[model samples]
Target: MSAAPEQAVAGRLSFLDRYLAVWILAAMALGLGLGRVVPGLGDALAEVTVTGVSLPIALGLLVMMYPVLAKVRYDRLDTVTRDRRLLLPSLLLNWIVGPALMFALAWLFLPDLPEYRTGLIIVGLARCIAMVIIWNDLACGDREAAAVLVALNSVFQVVAFSALGWFYLSVLPGWLGLEQSGEMGSHLLEQSRELGGVSVWEIARSVLIFLGIPLTAGYLTRRIGEKAKGRAWYESELIPRIGPFALYGLLFTIVILFALQGDAITSQPLDVARIALPLLVYFALMWAGSMALGRSVGLNYSRATTLAFTAAGNNFELAIAVAIATFGATSGQALAGVVGPLIEVPVLIGLVYVALYARRYFTTPAPLTEEDPAHA
Candidate 1:
């Protein structure tokens, strides 16, 4: 964070990274315009699916995830596992605090909009498994730590998502005496049944397709690349060529994702705003609080940033799928699910910058020996 390190970090960014916000905004606008103007765009995109996952979005996620995952020093992961300070807090924040906080905010912010409130709670229960890697990488977070924590989350998500959905949407509210609050309480059981209809196998399938493919590919790529060539050539020659694809993939995915819902987003401006407000507050508080907790527990800047991003991000793909399956594509709950990434993408990008700036306060850099995980 000294002027020298700050300047060095700034200098390290490529042109694409330097202007990431501009490219993302342009992608969003382009997607909205295309959706607004193009005929059958959504249907066309939807036609190409691999086991119910959108091909275009899947491609982008795979592309983005591979390079970052390949960058991890997989052998050094043992060090991360041994660090209870990092692992324990990550579990607590993602499973416990994250959902509970979102539940409170949904009730506090959208008291009358029961459907939207339910959607936000569902979003909270689905922890981050995909895009957190990109955010953490961009912020110079510890790649090994991010990988380990994300995998941990994926396991926990499969086990807990439905049960927690039941709790927050139905049981927890009743426990707090909100069961007699009229329509919201009366419909809790019905809503819980609808949300709970998404089976565990379905959620696990999502995790496998989205996270599993890229993770396996990334691991194989590193192993093969290093074996085919020496580690030096693999790192110095091949990585730079593949590195920019992550951004390209991100922009492509954004355009397609927003294009799919462009009409809804542009037409239902006020509704989008309503869904967005709680998401905004949720991301900000979760990221900042996680960062503070990480620092307090003696993590270095890289690990701390990794912790914050992973803690703050939600698996919107899962959330959207569950919402649509449970409540229909045209329902308010589904719309709330779509608006999640609409707000999350831009907000998280901004937080990456905030994290970089705040790195100055950490003072001492975390030691990274030859065995340590390097920045992705």
Candidate 2:
């Protein structure tokens, strides 16, 4: 924790980690160019589907999440769970506040654009389970805390996604007389009719594929690695080897996503801008508010950073899959889903610097208990 050790750590970072933002931007540009120049490229990727989910995208997410989860000291997760200060605020932000905030922003900003609005709502409901680990780790968050929170979000996602979709898209909108706007109401009704209800089964399938596979892989890797070579070897030797893959996977996913949606994003600049506005506001507010809440509740820097990133990030993989499955790959809803990452990637990367800077404001958190694993 001294300056010399910190300096050594900084010096040890791979060129990739040090310039992650540059790589991500280059990937976006490359994907956009590929999609534009190569006819049928997006369709080709779309066709490479397994169980109705895009195979390429799924692989990227799994690869992206696996290493970070593997790095968690799973045995210490109870520390996070018993600390109600972290757990309660995280749940409140991710489950209750996040979805409602997005719904409000979507409606407020895109009242007449039913497809994009609905897409934003769906993004809000699918809480972050995959790429959030990357953001959290980059911001030097509590790894074990992130692991627990991501698991919690996955469970809540399966249980609550469909019901929330019903509420936001159909039930609550009507209750608020949002449907009274004649033509827009009729358009939304027709859109809803076309899409049917958000399928619980599909959402569950996504959670299983995206979270379950990597989580299982990570747990077994740690268990087997530690049992064979001991924790020291696993941590000091193995973790560094695998750690870079998380960012690699992230960059790969970005390229594929932008490629698939390049034409839509390029042609409909104004629509993308409309969707991006709400999303920008949503990410900024959620992250800043969660950080403030964490500091107010006396959390240290790490858990507070974890809370902010997890609350700010959405499971865009799930959101996009659902949009394509329900609304067709080319629909405005799917376009909005694509735009989620466009805004999120650079913004969250910027917020990582903001978080490291803000760390000075948080006092050292008290120990979880006498036997706090972190302190030990």
Highest lDDT: which candidate? 1
Instruction: List TM-score per model, in order.
Output: 0.94, 0.92
Q: Which lDDT values do the candidates have, in the order given?
A: 0.85, 0.84
- Which residue segments of model 2 deviate by more than 4 Å? 1-8, 180-184, 193-196, 365-376
Candidate 1 regions with alpha-carbon error over 4 angstroms: 8-13, 180-188, 366-376
- Per-model root-mean-square deviation over C-alphas: 2.8, 3.9
- Taking the tens digit of each residue's C-alpha lDDT, what string does model 1 give over 1-376? 3466455555666677668899999999999888878887876876788777888888888888888888787888999999999999999999999999999999889988888888898899989999999999887889899999999999998999988888888788878975536675566568676666578998999889778988898889888999899799978887787777878888888998999888878989998898899999999999999999999999999999999999999999899889888877787888888899999999999998888778877966543222212221
What's the lDDT of the predicted structure labeled candidate 1?
0.85
Candidate 1 clashes: the total is 0
lDDT of 2 by residue, 1-376 (tens): 3346445555656677667779989999988888888898988988998988889888998899898889888899889999999999999999899999999999999988888998998888879988888888877789899988988998888888777777778778888888736776677666655444667788788889988899899999999999999998998888878877888899999899888878888888899999999999999999999999998898998999999999999989888887877777778888889999989988998898788767757776322221111111
Error of 2 at 74 (Å): 1.0
